[model samples]
Target: MIDLLLEMFSYMFLVRAVVVGLLVSLCAALLGVSLVLKRYSMMGDGLSHVGFGTLAIATAMNAAPLTVSIPIVVAAAFLLLRISENSKIKGDAAIALISTSSLAIGVVVISLTTGMNTDVCNYLFGSILAMSKSDVNLSIALAAVVLALFLLFYNKIFAVTFDENFAKATGVKTGLYNMIIAFLTAITIVLGMRMMGSLLISSLTIFPALTSMRVCKKFKTVTVCSAFVSVICFFIGVVISYVYATPTGASVVIVNIVAFLLFWATNLTIGRIKK
Candidate 1:
């Protein structure tokens, strides 16, 4: 165990991996809080597919995937928000349509691209082993931006999440706030794609929030606990992946699932005993 720790610390790639995991987890936790509260838990999944589609197109054009994907997904997020507000299409239905379309487009684009091994499986499932130093730095910057935005809009977001009608009554510009949340969700999905992949990235945004809400009674407590749990789960997943020679993203997600289930079970048992 000591040897593994020392080795992980010694390697630059391992350090990058750990840092990327931490930053992505923090971003997911922050966004997860609002997502869960708003009952938009599937938003992450939809944005991730949009990110994947952008990545595929970038790969075909021999451009930087992150550069291409971020802006596209952000724009798509705003469009979705507008559609949600102006049309009768339900939020989940909109998300489902977008996600399915993006995934289909991504798969088709990848197939048409020549000389690119389009590792759809890795992108779908996740591949922490593929993380680079640049990716880590980008993750850190993206996470910082998301955190800053969340802090700036914390009160409005709290109001909107709990009661949109009340927020609108209080002159909170609920539509604009919802749009901002969607924009941030898109960015978070793009940033997290490398660590969690398009398919499983939503887990990072959902599990920690779910676990924290199960145990914490207060909103502030839930936010803090979710972030803490997210960090711990990411680290554990990375370490376990290194030790077991498994895919880092899948391993971390599995760890998150296990942790969530354990906490949920404990919460349920305690509640029953209290009764």
Candidate 2:
């Protein structure tokens, strides 16, 4: 396995994918804990869907995909947050509204112009080859910013996640922190959509956090465990995808699903033992 990994990493594209994927996985895992607890886990999905729409439009216009997609998706993220916070459309309903609309637009645009070619398929379903050198560089920079900000604001994020109203009462800026979370999540979704695709990117956020929560009660513990689980599963999934010629996004999601079930079973067994 070590030898295989070394050989795989010898390729520049694979290295780019691994480097960006791992960073995106870490960012997604870290933010996912709070998002899941806040019932905003679907934000990743919504942003990725928005990303696809923008990417499709970019493709049609012969423009840079990331340049076109990033700002649009970030705007969509902020829009989703405001709608959830202010309007009658709240939580999953808000997410679903943005998600379905974006996905439909993307599908129509792609069908009209690109017509579901290999590159478009890569964006929709993820391919290791999806990350170009420029994409990797951009992804790395954005992912680092996401990680650094998350660490810097960890305490505030924790407060907002557990009790937003109480955090607000306690003089914490709950709304700002929530927007920060959404902004970071939107970036991660776009970065990861290269390797995990629009359809499967959210799994990188949702699975590891949920899996860790099954056994780890503390937020810090769950965050650390989720990071580990996400990176390991991504590595395994990449190896499997390479060897079996499977879709990178689907393979990663499958590995995450297996990990979640195992953690759930372990939690149940521990509960039984305690009883």
Candidate 3:
């Protein structure tokens, strides 16, 4: 395993992929706990679709994908939050409406200009080779910002995630904290989309939190466990991807599925033992 990992790291592209992917995994894991608790886990999926639309437009315009996509997707996140909070659309329906619209727009733009090429395939399905040195550097910087923000606002986010009404009663700006969560999630989704794909980026923000919940009851324990699960699964997935020549994103999701099942099984066993 060490030899294989060393061999994988010998390639600059692999090194970049691992570094950026790990950081994104950490960020996703942290933010995911809140989203999962709040039942807003699919926010990542919706924002990713919006990201795809913005990326397609960027590609057609010969502009930088991340630069163009970030603001648009962030705005979409804010819109999603507002619609879910105020409009009759509400929650899953609001997510579906925006996500489907963005996805359709992305497809139309791709058909008109890029015409489903290699770059488009990479954006849709993710490719390890897609991480240029510059892309890795930018992703690292952005991922750092995400980690810092999440850590700094941990208490406020925790309060809002668990009980928005209570938090508001306690004088916490629940709306502001919720928007911050959405903002962080948007950035995390975009940072991961290059390596995880727009279609699968959300799994990073979802599976770990759910897997941890299978065993850990407390929010803090679940959060910590989610981080560990995410990082370990990502590493194992990368190894599997290198050995089997599988798609990185799909491999990671499979690993996460296995992890979730194992945690679930373990929890069941403990329950039966107590019974």
Regions more than 4 Å wrong, model 2: none
Q: Compared with the true structure, what per-residue lDDT tens digits does model 1 show for residues 177-206?
A: 998898888888888786677888888889
- Can you write out model 2's per-residue Cα lDDT over 153-238, one digit (the tens) per residue? 99999999999999999899888998899999988898898689998999999999999999998989999999999999998998
Model 3 off-target regions past 4 Å?
none
Q: Estimate the overall C-alpha local distance difference test score of candidate 2.
A: 0.91
- Model 1, C-alpha of 100: deviation from truth (Å): 1.1
TM-score of each: 0.95, 0.97, 0.98
Cα lDDT tens digits for candidate 3, 1-275: 78988899999889899999999999999999999889998899999989888988998999988889899999999999999899888789999989899989998999999697887788888888878888888999999999999989998988998889998998999999999999999999999997898999999999999999999988889989999999999999999999999999999999999999999999999999999
User: Scored by Cα lDDT, where does model 3 land?
Assistant: 0.92
**Order of quality (TM-score):** 3, 2, 1
Say which candidate scores most in lDDT: 3
Worst 10 residues of 1 by lDDT: 113-122
lDDT values for all models: 0.85, 0.91, 0.92
Query: How big is the positional error of residue 243 in model 3, measured in Å on the Cα after superposition?
Result: 0.7
Q: Please count the clashing residue pairs in each candidate, in the order shown.
A: 0, 0, 0
